[model samples]
Target: MDYLRSTFVILTVIMTILTLLPFWRNQAWWVRVWDFPRLQMATLSLLFFLTEMALMPFGGPAAQIVIVLSMACAIYHALWILPYTRLYPKQVRASRLNNLPTLKIVTANVLMTNQQSDKLLALVEQHQPDILVTLETDLWWQAQLNVLENDYQHTLKCPQDNLYGMHVYSRLPMQDPLIQCVVAEGIPSMHFRVTLDSGDEVVLHCLHPMPPSPTEDDESTNRDGELVAVGHTAARASFPTVVTGDLNDVAWSRTTRLFMKISGLLDPRRGRGMFNTFHATFPFLRWPLDHVFHSKDFTLRDLQRLPEIGSDHFPILVELALNPRVGKGQRGLEIEPGDQFEAREKMNNAGVKSRHVHTAEN
Candidate 1:
């Protein structure tokens, strides 16, 4: 009984320590990785603390302190994610205009190894989204999705086998189309202007930054740096904008929040749900790596996590309506002098030097 109690107490302390480490703002892959599973951590901490309290009421002062500290850590982690749940008010208001120009987009990261092009095709056919963005596509996936050309008139395709390929297909016409490598080589992000039926043009930025893991890069510097670059681009835009893709980071992460603030975009998931979209095969270990964010000129119409299509990531579909009065008086994250200095430092660390390849429409 003593050994079991000691083990539980040790594990509780370890989890509490891990939860607190992310507050250091360290860019190391291991530390940033902790930002991905706040919900899971909170749940586990709650369960362990409750079990310890119920099973070992007389387990000494150290055990009691550990249990209490673990409980507090659980609440702390939960507070960071609470805004993403229905418990908090939505950051973007719902659209009430019946004739508003609405755009529906589906963003999915088809595992480069997942040969389920047919499933993705069926999903596109079913949803009939105005725009579709796919990540981790290779030459084979590009060929398989080429059939979509019949419906989508404008396209920006960068097919690479290096696990960073991206393709964007749109029914609406695109202007000033560009494909640029934001962070590391072989990874590309798309930026263009898509015109709606109402003649309004919205700037769209698509991204799929590399994730931090043992097999991949050693640090999250590149991912965080790339997001900061894109956020700055979005912030400078004079028109309505939409940014979507598999960010490879969770909504509550510090980097993600900073990106949102710097870009002046709003997340539809706020005050709605977590909409976990990754690790589709493992129900116990899922987080939202897929995202769709838009400027204040837009309001929420609908957002959903689509059914799995044999890939590790569940696709995310977001519908947004354009409203001229949307962002008035809404507070946005201001870029402080320190933030500007940090952004420059991150950009330098990222080593992004590629020029955007501009393609004239056919």
Candidate 2:
């Protein structure tokens, strides 16, 4: 009985230590996987700490192991909750533009099998954003979304039932809209250039890759590979860019962070909050999977989560202001130079081979 108790206690300690692996030295890989089940980790950690305290009266090898496990779990819980503390810090100065051209973009994953087109159309009409991007779209979904054509002049539709299905609609003039297969078969992404009335150009890339799941794709490598490859492409582009879609990864994950660093884009949520968009039905088990990342040439005007439109994922609405005065020093969010090296290594480790495309036009 004593030996069994000891074994259980040791196993618990090991599991507690595993939770803290995210903060260990050079542990980006650890942090990537730690992104999942964050809420459950927090709750379990707290419960373990209380259990250890109650077991103090029964001093033995089991008690000692429980105490150690409790400490480790507590530390990890604290670390996991710390990143959100200064997510969106208060800016020292506000923009001077009184009449800035605010571009509102919305992104939603409409679940390919869902037939509630009326709810989605109602949400879009209510928001009236400048651009709308939908994931998991099929032929029927495309046909239903055609109602948006009167407001949005430009469209790029890749309506497939596969994991990569995507559709994009824009009120601004779009140039060279094309669907590019990023990594695996059936995973397509839409790329286009939006020409604003002020003559400023903004390149937009819409992506929706297959997520990692036991029943779906057993490996997350392809999804990670596709994002990194697209990140590299966006990084090399000269124009200001906005990459939006259902990324299938959390905003704070190593892969997502690396993508932001490599692409040199700014996350509006950084000084704000986690715009948790997935699993709309269960808000508690949600993470910010749908995102809008823009170059520093633009500043955030506003951002919010749209009401549920009968899909598992909620739509993200973001309004950005073009800062004409933003120059070399204030182009966008600045990431440490070392981050790029780490990002490159992670991408390589994920088996993402780099291939450059001259333009999305071809």
For this target, which candidate reaches the highest lDDT against the unseen true structure? 1
Q: Where is model 1 poorest over a 10-residue stretch in terms of lDDT?
A: 353-362
Each model's lDDT = 0.85, 0.73
* lDDT score at residue 333, model 2, on the 0-100 scale: 38
Clash pairs, candidate 2, are 87-270, 87-271, 88-271, 88-272, 296-331, 296-332
Error at 14, model 1, angstroms: 1.2
RMSD of 1: 2.5
TM-score of each: 0.94, 0.84
Q: lDDT for model 1, on a 0 to 1 scale?
A: 0.85
The TM-score obtained by model 2 is 0.84
Candidate 2: stretches off by over 4 Å: 1-34, 54-65, 77-81, 85-96, 324-354, 357-362
Could you tell me how far off, in angstroms, the CA of residue 285 lies in candidate 2 after the best superposition?
1.8
Q: What would the per-residue lDDT of candidate 1 be over residues 1-362, giving only the tens digit for each residue?
A: 77877788888989988988888867788888999989899999898888888768787788779888888988988998998899998788888778889999999999889998999999999999999999999999999999999999799999999888999999999998889876678879898999998998888889898888888888889988888878877777777888899998999887888888777888889889999998999998998899998888888788999988889999999999988686554555566657766766766778741122221221
Given candidate 1, what's the lDDT at residue 258? 81
Model 2 weakest 10-residue run by lDDT: 85-94
